[model samples]
Target: MWKLERCPPHTGHQYLYHGSEEEELHVSRQVGAWLRLQGDASISRKHASLKVSHSAQAVKRSICGSIELKELGAKNGTFVKHSNSQNSAESEAREAPVFTEEHRLSSGTEVVLRHGDVVRFGLYDYCYRLVRCELLVATSMLPRSDTVMRDLLLLGGSYSKEWTQNCTLLVMETIKLSAKVACALACGRSVVRPDYLTQLCTAVKQKQQQLPATRDYLPTITEASIQPDPSLFDPNHDRKSVLSGKLFLLSSPKLLKRVQCIVEFAGGKCEVVAARHHSMIEAGDAVILRTPDDANLPSQSPMAAACKVVKRAGLHVVRESDVVLAVLYCSTERFCNPALSQQVLVSTISQSQMQQQNTGIIYAPETQAISNSPASVLSSRSNKTTRTTSAIIPETPGSTGPSSTLIKSPFTPAATATIARA
Candidate 1:
């Protein structure tokens, strides 16, 4: 009886991540990686040979969504076959599967493994193996293989006009390049398709080009004053503070409500109004933002307006702040794509706050006053508890605990916010 070596061609009936033997297979031949099946099965193929291995506990992930697979050095090199035969060489090399969501390994047949190749199992443990064969080259370069492939894909013309206009491809490709290959490939064929890769490349390129050109001027938020509409504000002719200036809140409607509640509870009254058109804000104002759960929203929604506000007002309101207690309620599961979640996490990372320091437009937890207001007490709690209300005219509800309220001191520097609505 020939014992399974458990080495090189380590044929196993089970997977570390999926925990099964009969798994689905999708290979990106270009990058020499495979995508894990969605069901409970593990798959292994040998390059240049006719044997394939299977198990029952394999995991599954998506192309552009959650779950990913990466390859480790294995005796059998994973291959991704394409639909078109005319450009087989070009397609084979370019479509060489790494852990990318652009292309899946459907339709194409799995090839036998040889030396210097790799195979990835599933998402949980993200297990992978490298078949020790003479063909194995330096494994160090594989870590950055995605980057080189992206550059190559961009230069090779594998995207479309819609992808460029919409900026989907580039973003997706950027993520693929950033992710570990072993984890990417385990996601399986659903995430290893051709159209997906092309789209990702296009979107990423567009975003890279749209970066702000100058730090001095940002786009206007809401310059057109609604002061004429008495319904918009109170008619306090002499009373200076009345939601008079504008602020841009670049947050989701849900989060906006929560923050507003916190402010009101803390005795600070501010209006959650629509952003203005091309309006610039004064320093010492607040800009609140809720990181977009969907990657497409930031590019499609009021994000452009917020960017304009930031450029002109010299302010950027981040999500995590200590001066103005920002509460975070995001979970990794809410996002469809892990890459998109990562981007949100990066944008929302917590930052330290300085006491009584005011930073303009982008609300740094400083207590600087952007506008001048006469002294007036804002009563939040009816009892002995003290509530700090903002001088801004619009009033909101009151607070319950230390974690809910953000108090702005009177001595802080003055700033104004400018908002715009699309």
Candidate 2:
């Protein structure tokens, strides 16, 4: 079944349409057995029609197929706002009617409605949100006493009541009920029980506990083990600055201090900005906005405003997990591709260091060999030997000769002369 509830700024009234019973529903101001919006002069006599098409295999009492909305060539026009389950942040940022007078739908143009879609009738403030309800069996047929369904509903109601009374962070909603139904269906059962919810919650908590905390185990960048860009070795430079030159804009107020500490420790700059001041967002700056895990944010809230600004500026919005992984890997590239493992990053750095070492090697100029034996000196000169040396070799503070001298041409005149002079 699908119900259309009036949106905000309007009366909280809903019109229900059962797919099995109603093939079509008419909305108009002048009505007899139709969805009538009284006292609204903007609405046409035959404003729009909702055509319900059910799936061939749809079970009785369950919502299946779709509802097609068609405009009846009204003067004011009809508009729709689609519901985006994915990228809800972006959707919230850019929430607006999909149609206007200039972009009005043609007569008989059909639009398939989905759950959460809002439809505006005419040009007035009158709007209705389409809501879907999944009731697979008849209400009278459902077991009411001493059944798993009854027990689960009772348990959920109790938990909800307790949470409300105690002012706890937990929230119980229809999604939880839907999840229970899904679990029951998966297990070849017709209903959910309280024990199932309890077991699932316990298993979820255990899994959460087993997961590693990214902040605690992030790898620290060390100068000794890895060679960074030579410019980073300036006297004022921070050795631990892996996120140098990057700027982060935090949208969530709660994560300001913790995220600031982490970003600064890694040589990155971060600051929390008000949603109104989103114009300050620069091109290279990344917005760190944590997705709400519990429920959808109110459209008028500051977080939604911030999301709007981010969306308008086309700035990169990353999650806390992405920031953590990027810091752990010591590469801003990891921001977009956080799936990369720590071992892969370590191996990549090692290979980079090896390449730098190989490319930075400075070989000594070929030296002419002077020996007591003319034949030996001639042979050395003809060979034209060169010695490989490090560009920045480490040495003892008080050492006179090279730490480890390379010997070549045993018959050299220098060694022979020293021996004869001794």
Candidate 3:
């Protein structure tokens, strides 16, 4: 299994669909995606295709292991974006009077894409990655005659730490800059440089310090949540410490105040009342409290009737154990450390960085996150210019076989270690 992860999920500005097919799976738009690129005026009806096929090997291979992005003949053709390894060549190259002449990607050609192969179009670029490379490659033109393909297909390769760090840093920096640009524009700061992307890479290398390796797993603190300290019942605690997200407690009077204090201590806006304060539950709760078991559902009413009452209210009922999970998922702004989340993201990107690790790839058929598999692929070309670039697989061997590209970190040995540890 291999995947193409969209760093910042929203690829375009607007969205639309006929009312009839709104709920269909793989619902495609008239614009902006593998489903179609109709959002921009510079695009044509059928620019290119993102195809999955059996490797164009001399022999048959069991695993249907190749991806082809073939051009459909149009103005302003496709290009493959290379990393900073060739900055000088890139600057001079794109500035050439014509784009596709030096390296031509003619229509209907198959590019056996590797991980992090950035495919460029008229207005946007997308990165594709091949996972489980050993098996996929074994079946391709790259002869299984060697141990390289044999080991990958049989024994998994130990991911290169240095390569992982560099690629992770590059992806992270892009994600960060994209966010920064968005924030700047939101603050009415119109000026921004796309080149800041590379600078971000440099800065991350400078500021990052080595951290001790640790397990990466979601925390299970919900079940063991601490009761509010007795002193919290103290009338003197600062009210400003209330958390940002709202929490509404709709349960027994005995559990109300203690729960409210606990939630508030974590900075949530808690709403609770004594049992005598209400009859039926209130309507405004974004998240409503429910007991861990049916024992607390009101001894007076039958379980079915109580469930009916809850179902009518449009409330997301969560147990006590879910409190912490909810806060982190919804509003991790105040309580949780931002550093932890960064570490998690960096680690995932590092492990799956296309240039290094190509094993354990899975096709996620989702618009926002990898899910099943994309049921629809959309592409459009420009009607105006005939431009294209040779598909570049960075640092790949000999005569430009598209299956694999192993990239090295640009950081010094000292910085590479620290970045990897971080």
Model 2 regions more than 4 Å off: 19-22, 60-63, 86-103, 137-422
* RMSD to the hidden true structure, all candidates: 22.8, 27.9, 28.3
Which whole-number lDDT from 0 to 100 does residue 376 have in model 2?
A: 21
Clashing residue pairs found in predicted model 2: none
Q: Positional deviation of 117 in candidate 1, in angstroms? A: 88
Candidate 3 residue-wise lDDT at 63: 33
Instruction: Order candidates by TM-score, high to low.
Output: 2, 3, 1
Local lDDT at 203 for model 2? 37
Which whole-number lDDT from 0 to 100 does residue 29 have in model 3? Answer: 26
Candidate 2 structure quality by residue, lDDT tens digits, 295-399: 255777665676666556544345443444344344566442223344454345445444332221111221112211111222122223322211111111221
Q: Give one digit per residue, the lDDT tens place, for model 3 in 156-229.
A: 21212111111111111011111111112122222212222223223322322222111111111111112212
TM-score of each: 0.19, 0.30, 0.22
**Cand. 3 Cα-lDDT:** 0.30
Error of 3 at 16 (Å): 23
lDDT of 1 by residue, 1-422 (tens): 00111223334322111112343233322234333223323333321212223211110110111112333332332332122222222234555433322132332334433222333332222233322211001111111334424432232222221111111122121111111111111111011223333343444333232222211121121212111221211111221121223243534554454334333322233333246533433344544443322124555456555555555564444331211321111111221111223334333321111222232222111212322332233332222323222322111123121222222321212111111110
Clashes of each: 113, 0, 22
